[model samples]
Target: MQIPDYMVVPSLVVVVIILLGIAFWARYKTVGPDEAMVVTGSFLGSRNVMSEEKDRKIKIVRGGGAFILPIFQQAEYLSLLSLKLDVSTPEVYTELGVPVLTDGVAIIKIGGSVEDVVTAAEQFMGKPTEALKAEAQEVLEGHLRAILGSMTVEEIYRNRDKFAQEVQAVAAKDLKKMGLQIVSFTIKDVRDKHGYLDALGKPRIATVKRDAEIAEAEAVRDARVQKAKAEQEGQKAELLRDTFIAEAEKEKVLKIASYKREQDMAKAEADQAYFIQEARSKQSVVDEQMKVELVRKDKEIELEAKEILKKERQYDAEVKKRADADRYAVEVSAEADKA
Candidate 1:
């Protein structure tokens, strides 16, 4: 078939546009936040900024877009998320010669630094998360076994955090070479076939119980002694109270007796004064009667002296009259004789 001359120019232009569109689409690729896109190919003697060596030309794009020459470069993705692994070891002998099995878990991820990403790109590029987990589990189990061999079973059981730390420290170097880092490692359990841990704790438990019983007995003895002392104090207080009451009664009786003696003395003094007053009154009456009888005897003696003087005067007059009669008779007789 012969083509038209004007149709040929337009057909050539349409073909160029289609090829350029295809090339543009193939050169531009977008990478997600959790993924790194690695591009590798011949660079026409130009240096690749993502790689240090000029012979092995490669570029890594993360969280953005990159341009790739259609035939000179290729693109691949690696996950940036963490991976979990299970760690289990068969029965292993400890430093104390005890056989034990250990079970644990670990979390790992590809490092995010430029150097670490380069390492990850060279080692784990295009590998699945399961493949990375399997690799990490094998490395961690070996380390766990080695650490267990250096420690006693009691140390492993009591300090699981320390045990995990030791395992992570030892395994971190190897995992780093494979471009992975351990976020965490934990030991879930440790067990033995012979029940050695249970047997080891028995003596300590028995000792604790025995000490508790002894403390309880000592506390009871102390309480009994305190109770006895309290009873003795109560009895002494009662005895003191009774003695005080008895002394008080005796003092009251002595006061009453002394008061009665003073009252008796006062009564005796009053009676003696009354008797002396009565005797003085009787003696005054007898003295007045004796003075009246003395006056009556003096009047009787004066009357007797007057009566005797009158009788003596009468007798002297009678004698003088008789003598006068005799003298007259004699003178008459002498006259008769003379006649």
Candidate 2:
């Protein structure tokens, strides 16, 4: 077909734009967070990798995008994500000559440093993550067997953390050469055919039971002793109260008896005084009557003596008169005879 001269320049411009867009899309590449983009082939000079080995020629891109030249550079991806390994060992004899089986789990990954990535690219660039996991698990199981042979069954069973640490420490140096790191390693279970562990716990259980019985007996004895002491104190208090009451009653009785005795004595003395006064009054009346009788007897004797004297004087006078008359008559008769 014949093309127009003015249309050829515009068509050529449109074809160039479309070719450039396709080339740009094909050259641009990106890697995610869990992927490492490895670029290998001819380079201008040493770049994007930190490896001391001159023979390894590779560039690693992680977590970003890069433009790849089509002919000189080929892009390959390596995994940066962690891998889990189930590590187990067959029955192996320990240091104590006891056979044991051990099981464990481990987490491993390719190291993140530039040197580690470069080193890993040389060894494992074409392997899958599952192939990496199998290779790491084999190394771990080998170290676990070596550790078990050096330790006794009791040491491995009782101190699992120590056993795991020893295994990790020993395996790290060998794994580093392959550009792998041990994120974590732990022992899950340990088993033996003979019953050695159960026999070890029996003595401690017997001692604990003995101590509990002794403590209970001592508590009962202490409770009984406290009850007896309380009863003794109660009895002593009652005895002291009874003694005080008896003494108070005795004092009351003695005081009442003494007061009654004093009252009887006072009454007896009053009666004696009244009787003595009455006896004195009767004696004074008897003495006055005897004096009056004595005075009347003396007056009667004086009157009788006066009457006897008057009668004696009258007898004497009559005798004198008779004598005088006789004398006169004698004288008269003598005179008549003379006449």
Position 196, candidate 1: lDDT: 90
TM-score, structure 2 vs. true: 0.56
- Using Cα atoms with residue i matched to residue i, what is each candidate's TM-score against the true structure? 0.54, 0.56
What would the TM-score be for candidate 1 when compared with the true structure? 0.54
lDDT of 2 by residue, 137-174 (tens): 88899999999999988788779999999999999877
Model 2: which ten-residue window has the lowest total lDDT? 44-53
lDDT of candidate 2?
A: 0.83
Residue 64, candidate 2: Cα error in Å is 0.5
Stretches > 4 Å off in candidate 1: 1-22, 44-54, 201-339
Q: Per-residue lDDT of 289-312 in model 1, one digit per residue for the tens?
A: 666666666556655655555555
Cα lDDT of all candidates, in order?
A: 0.81, 0.83
